[model samples]
Target: MRKVLDPFSLGMWAMILLVITITATLGVWFNTERRNSNPDRRQSFWQTKNPQRRRKSAYVRLALDSFLQKGNFFCGASVEHDPNANLASKILAFGFGFFILITVSAYVANLAAFLTRSEFQSVTTVNEAIRKGYTLCAHPVVENELRSQLPNAKFFFHENGKEFIGMLKDYDDKKCEALVIGWEDTSTDIDFLSMLCERSLVFTDSVLAEISMGFPIRPSLSAGFSYWMYYGQKFEDINIPNLKEKYSPTEALDSQCVIQLSELSLQSADEYAMITVQNMYFPLVFFAVCALIGIILQCIYAFSSNRRSLIGRVSQLDLTTTGTTARKDRFLMRRRSRMKSRDGTQDDGRFRDSRIEATEE
Candidate 1:
């Protein structure tokens, strides 16, 4: 694990070390070369007049003289002190923005497709479609030729139907572009076919444009030479050589040049499904789980509050009954004690009165 992550973690440090080493080596070489080339002591006269101009002019003269001496050196000189200030800053800003846009746009597009369960779709040329891994639907003859050229791509076949019919209705529904028959169809009325072609923007001139049109054509148009036959010239221009076959020096040069050029023109689309699976789906699932937990907690709180309210009502009822019974007992005890004490006091007074009467008599 440590070894695996070391590359990503220490990439910046490695780059910085490389830059420092290159700068130090170049500086030492440049100083040594400058000292070796200019060993005269005429600097005393120049320093007396203007030291700043003397230093600047000496560096400029050295650079220009060095470039002149080296035949392979393709150097351009500028007198400005801050030659690339504005251009350098603008280029840096543009690069930063471009990288940010690429990363963010890739994220957003993938996220949208993932959440919706749909692939991001776009129309592309026949060559472009093949590059992006989309199979073309065509006749057996066309498929055979195409397959012979592109073994990696899978091709679909439609029997009896016209070329456009095969591509539009029979091919993969989710894919954006399909190879269809165009104005090159022979049996259809030329005027009507032209109208259809115009409405569909089915241009037979370009390989990609033909793939973009969603329609089929009759066999005469497929076999006969018209716009479709003329379009074969573009295929010749592609110049894809057979992998198994050997070629002459000229053929080899031509093949290599075409291959290099084709690679330059080609651009691979980002795979939205992979991005969605990696970035968006997990986050969405986690957020949904958190939401469900919150709802369960709310239900628990509501039930708990109701239970607490019922317990409070019961406690209040019991307290009220206890207070009323205690008051009633106190009242009854007081009444009985008061009656007993009063009767005792009356009896004592009566006995005293009788004794006093007897004594007086």
Candidate 2:
């Protein structure tokens, strides 16, 4: 059987990367959720000093330390008020500072790498070397280099103003062939290197250069980038119809799925498209839901406050017969002048009389 037919060969690196990423994501997600779901001040994880004894694993210990540190940052307890809380906070602060230091160090290392000549190597084929009348496409830079080296051979630029790199994995069941041009010189598995050497064709009189762009290889950082390099001017690798599927484009590319550079273009394209569409409407949806919730809460508050005010006002109001009689006496006194005016001979008196007769009915 062909070695490439093995499942282990197909997605080994992808699986390993996926595992690490998943762990980091879950750690962040569950950690945040645990904090939000259980805000009880009494239930602190740092209090258990022997947590490692119960739960074995350096990673777990690291997680516990991380959680303790984050907790301390949020809860600024004084040393005198709560010694334990203060200690936990200090431990967390130390860990946090350490993590930041490491991250900065990695970024610095990555930057420093760009200054030096990359160990990356490339195999070139002269336009004359390739079989005559065979279609050949290359990057503008690649094409220029070939043109300079081989003045006798004819060259045609790819259409669409875009160089055809390689077909990404196709939607068909069969995998596509790859046409590699150049690759980086990072530490790779010797076996994998040997496999590459054996399976890949190397051209005679190909120029080798020590060029530095960033990392050892493009694939180390981005699978999509690597995929392009691997299959430049090659056919696509389609999805197998009846293959036992662990992942799919539709489900894996959903908004719930996190974005990572390591995903293949077929997967990434779907994910990117989904995110682009959702982002367009996500803000509007969030605001609408928030407004609805706010309106409901405001109505509840208003109803409660109004009910309380009504009860309080009713208690203060007088309802005795004595109070009613006093009010009636005040009304009678106010009407005495009007009654006298109606009896007198005047246009106003007549008008008042008509109003009184209307009221009497």
Candidate 1 residue pairs in backbone clash: 125-208, 164-215, 164-216, 165-216
Best by TM-score: 1
lDDT of 1 at 242: 32
Candidate 2: clashing residue pairs, number: 10
| Cand. 1 Cα-lDDT | 0.42
Question: Number of clashing residue pairs in every model?
Answer: 4, 10
Q: Candidate 2, which ten residues in sequence have the lowest lDDT sum? A: 165-174
Please give, for residues 1-361, the per-residue lDDT of candidate 2 as tens digits. Answer: 3322221223432432332343333333233212222444423442344556534464466555545544443233211122323222333333333433433343344334334422214323444334343333333456656666655554444434533322111101123222323432211223323333444332233442334464366656688766675575355543233221323333423343322213333453442221122322433344335434544544565577679878887432555765666666556644765676688845466655765654443
- lDDT of each candidate versus the true structure: 0.42, 0.39
For candidate 2, what is the TM-score?
0.18
Cα lDDT of model 1 by residue, 115-144, tens digit: 544322544355666678766666654665
Q: Which stretches of candidate 1 lie over 4 Å from their true place?
A: 1-121, 160-166, 171-176, 180-183, 186-201, 207-361
lDDT of 2 at 93: 32
